[model samples]
Target: EQVKVSKQNFLLGRGERLTDDIVIKGGGGPKEPPYTFGEARRRLSPMVSETSSRIDELPQAACPGDEAVISLTINPEYVAKSFFPHELMRDVGIEVIGSRPKKTVPEKRSRGREPSEVFTTELFARGRRAAIRNWSQQLPDWRSDRGSANALISIEEISAPVPHAKIKGSLPEQGRMALETVLHASELEFSMIQAFAAYLESQGIEADLGHSFFAKGLCFLELDAPVERADDIALFTGVRTLRQMPSLRILRPTVRSADIPTTDLELPTEGPVSEDVRVAIFDGGVPENHALTQWTSRLELPGMLPATEGFLSHGVGVTSAALFGHIDTKVPLPRPYANIDHYRVLDEAPGQDPHKLYEILGRIEGVLSSQEYDFINLSLGPCLPIEDDDVHAWTAVLDDRLSRVSTLAMIAVGNGGEGDSILGLDRVQVPSDCVNALAIGACDTPGKDWQRAPYSSKGPGRSPGLVKPDLVDFGGEFSRPFVVVAPDATPSLTTTGGTSFAAPSVLRLGTGIRAHFGSNLNHLAIRTLLVHTCEEGDQDHKENHKEIGWGRVARSLDDIILCDDDTVRVVYQGEISPAKYIRAAIPVPADPMSGMVTIKATICYKTQTDPHHPGNYTQAGLEVTFRPNDSKYSRNNQVHPNSASFFGSSLPGATEDELRRDAWKWENCLHAVQRKRGSSLINPCFDIHYNARLEGRNFAPPESLSYAMVVSIHAKGVADLYDQVVRQYATQIEPLRPVLEMPIRT
Candidate 1:
């Protein structure tokens, strides 16, 4: 077919032909003759112009491939004038303002060719460098592919504004058309934006652009002007989809500030002596140079070893409180007890192997065997809501091994704060969370009052629950009296708050109790002794509640285990007053099968020699006990056994209704006292219990032969004190009293 070659058919960069027949022809105009260089004057000679021409008169032959090469040159001034078309510039919201004079390049010529040449140049910009390069790579492929069917195009560079002058590539054919389309769209969007900006600016409002993926399809017009102006513009725009630009958050370094007041809680009487009593503080080890080193004189500690790291300082602080607590006015901290031992685990690696805990147990056991330590204080732990199987296995091992050991272990409930998670009171934290461990909770310090440290982890153990934080003690706080270092000294001290501090205080009390009450101490007995010696308070007294573990803490060693003859007589000491009636539970023995026993009572007080010491006398007193009967004794003359029965009945003879009546009777007594004295008393009850081991189904090992006897004295009077009474007798009373195989007839 003889295809008519149309002048309008334009060839693409890639070998492709466009069918569009739209080409402009040059008009044939008057011609001028070529001037001879020798005939013309030099000034009048035409400037030498470079042009491509065939060297031979023969017509140009076709090359193999279907591609055409065209030559062209652009005036630098023309490109500078339209550098960034107004439409494209407005998209970025930058004004063209003006441009610098164009620098012209000398005209060039190639042998038998025109001066123009095509080459690719890379584009880049700071921050936007990646985006520009990415765009550039896509250009050639995109232009060639699309231009094959549209307008063929090429890219170029031009001078730019700001940060040195440089321009990106441009398109000559199809590319130019595509770029123009983009520019046109940007111009339309910018026009709307400018009109809105001007409207806002006139009302004293300014707007800026911000990215917002969540704005859906809507564009973000940030309120940069002012809050009121921005709000006005936003409301005025009727653009409900607009959102305020997020503000950048400011972050600044933090510096801790602390101020501690001097305390005068020291007693004139020398500290009650405690010797080679090994009390192991399980926590971060104290650096010898610490300000708290001064109190080393008072602690009954073993060799110091490191605990876990990261949060190790907490353990260090606890150790200081437990083993080396001494307060001095000018010195801030007085000399510490030189003999105390310390075990540290300052490595704070998370999820540490708990076997280390077992090793620590072994160390405590060694100390116990050597008769070096009387008690061990464990202030570090991996507290838990419920014991993990692994933890239970270890605990069972600890209970078995420790049940036979003599040293006392006092563990701290963690300081996870009273959060609903790990440390919540409902979740008893561990080693303190361990069944046999004497878990300690934090109390207000200085006056040694009851108030949970804000951070103390609390708990309601296993369902139906077991009591936790077996005891409470002063942790530390500004409101409480504590000895701390002055801020401006070469070495300074400050009061810190945490359960870490409280564990030590209770340890001191336990060690002091152990020292006062001679050897043969069992876990139950020690637990009982501490529980019996506590000074009880209301919910306001301790962190969680009155039921938070044991709601008492020992204030004086004599409160429990008073030296009487060959026996150390124990007591459950509590606050007593005229405003409230006090009731106590004393242990008595009875056959669980028979379920019958009689309760006996006594009332007396130590005679007051001096009017000064109020503790020497008591107007209200009672000794209520359940005395067990020996099976061999004849009915009438049966001498009571000093143990209590915890089974068969909730209360042996009292009907539910009768029990209620008795409760009312106790209340009446309290009311009568309050009415007479014009103030009800907040009685701290001192209930007492005693025990003896016999051949029974629930036999414990020799070390655990004795059970705990719990004596509870309360303002409201006694209620179901049997379990605690049994624990007390099993732990405290039995360990102290001699056990005979059979009853003796005198």
Candidate 2:
């Protein structure tokens, strides 16, 4: 077999250190010798110039025939020659052939068909370490056949294909002895002395002191290097460290949504009844006088530095916009409602602490359990490595623990620009990384680049593949303050951009949808609506976009005012299973007994699958809704259901006050269910299940359901029958009931 020489196989240098080498044009392996030097000279004469009289100094063996292996390396200039073909000397007796990749190389040369590139580089937060002890040892014949001399190739540089800095030096006698001592004592492999010697040289320092070998890439129990050079070492060869990238320019606010200022649309000015719903803002604290609230209070983080400081005003700004942006001010914006119960977690002193955060999460749990909050928005995160199980596991624990109790725990994906924190196995931040947690990434409209904000973190997920951010919203500066605060306070609003800002806007929008629609609004359903009804763009083009996980979200404040309906429409496909349930909820206004009301519901859906792989299946559906007559009961049943209870529920009559008391029980139960708990009270029982058979197994296709319930009330005897008709038409629904039941099995 002819050894094929290819340009791609040729590498400039191995590892981090720069070095050079030359190659032998053609040669056969050991065990064969040419008849005489003169005979070899004659065979090589045509390939050499007359000045190359010393060519015969090296001997060549004859080809061993077509069945035998032949080894050779092409001249470096062979690249210049573009794989120039050459005729072999027939007398050599070897069958010269094109070279194949190592994987495709004949089995005999492989000794035992071992895999190539079977090496791992241990990545740290900053750098990576690779061990060459298990690397294949190059045989003497291998070098001679390749036309390389007797120098041993350093495995550190050439072992793996990745590029990095390398250090090389001779270890001190004492250092080498100490290294040997430590290695022997610790039952380690490789020459620790040599490794340390090289490391010192790479760091531009001298190590006269001895060191010991430790396991897992830690070669030193102690070192002789100077301590002052620590910064330099960390900057260069130390663990993976990173510098913040250059900051981006703040872009101007530009709205492109069809819902923005489209054909003067007037909403029911006095239609919405203040529910006094409390929602927590898990970001920077709220600012006093913020347009959302004329009245505000502060919460303290136990270990915070400044005692009274909040993370920042960013979170408060978001909440203010969401719950009460509709306040009257000299600089009047869209201040809709003033009802809000806010919790500030991020901007507290000494920065946000996860431990403290667990407490905050507990607080959210309490609020949710007490039925005091309509939702909670988390606009903050941590700057830690999250690509491993420990971090992800921790985040999972939080999500599992918190999500069950909170009405909505919205987390931000962080404003860490693309590729910023990707170093050292670092993944997206925690909380957002947690499963069941809704992570939100930011989007800028008429976005300067007409693209998603450059800073928004993206994900399919780093570790367990959590469906992060659930949805996106216009989180840019333009929607800030307005989307962030409730509609009662007055505060200075400024430019704020982040998934943090977007999160609140979506949260508020969700609340509004739920308020006018109903509390049964399933977030997944809203996410689907955003994906389907939001402004659409080139789908094929977004395949590579990381930030715009789905695409630009489409929101319609206008549509919400005009639309009058609610529902869960399931279009079944394939065999449905009983294992997975399709759960949905919508907001329902209080039912009014004094007047007539109207309610309309519908469900629309379709079966979909990958065009290329139809065997893989999924389902999608939609439901339009309308309610003209919603009864406002004096005693509203606002009971909070456990996570599982919410997933699949059976109802009983209870006033809103009673419901608040059960909220925590509901959340705790839900959390337990997520943890796979079993018990009659907490176990998931009622649900519309679907099975999406995957591979040879059937499973549930992803399911989503949304709900909205609206109710209008009127005083009795205040109007004529015809006038009463108009009033009743405005709000007419009494304890609305529209349900869907489906069974799917895997």
Q: Write the per-residue lDDT of candidate 2 for residues 1-746, one digit (tens) a residue.
A: 88753211100011111111212122335422212323333332332222122212211111011011212322211211112222221212222221211111111212333333321111111111111111112221232333222111100111111111111112332321211111111125344345434555765676453323232222223333454443333222221211111111111122221122223222224422335444566445655554344334455445434424324445455565465432223333443433555565443443222234334444444444555355666665444334431222224334434434435556766655555454522234555655445566666663333455665666544322223444556666444222333222422333445665676666666565445434334443333334333443344553323445444554544333222222111111112222333332222222322333222111212233211111111112121111122222234562223222331121122224223322111110110011111111121112223223221123344543222212111223223322323233233212222121111111
lDDT of 1 by residue, 536-627 (tens): 56635333332345455755444454322212223322322222222342332221212222221111111101111011101122222222
Score every model by TM-score. Answer: 0.40, 0.40
Could you say which candidate leads in TM-score?
A: 2
What's each prediction's clash count? 80, 129
Model 2 C-alpha lDDT versus the unseen true structure: 0.33
TM-score of 2: 0.40
Local error of candidate 2 at residue 617 (angstroms): 22
lDDT (C-alpha) at residue 567 in model 2: 19
Residue 306 C-alpha lDDT in model 1: 38
Candidate 1 Cα misplacement greater than 4 A, ranges: 1-272, 288-312, 324-338, 348-372, 387-394, 421-426, 445-449, 463-465, 477-491, 516-525, 539-547, 561-704, 708-746
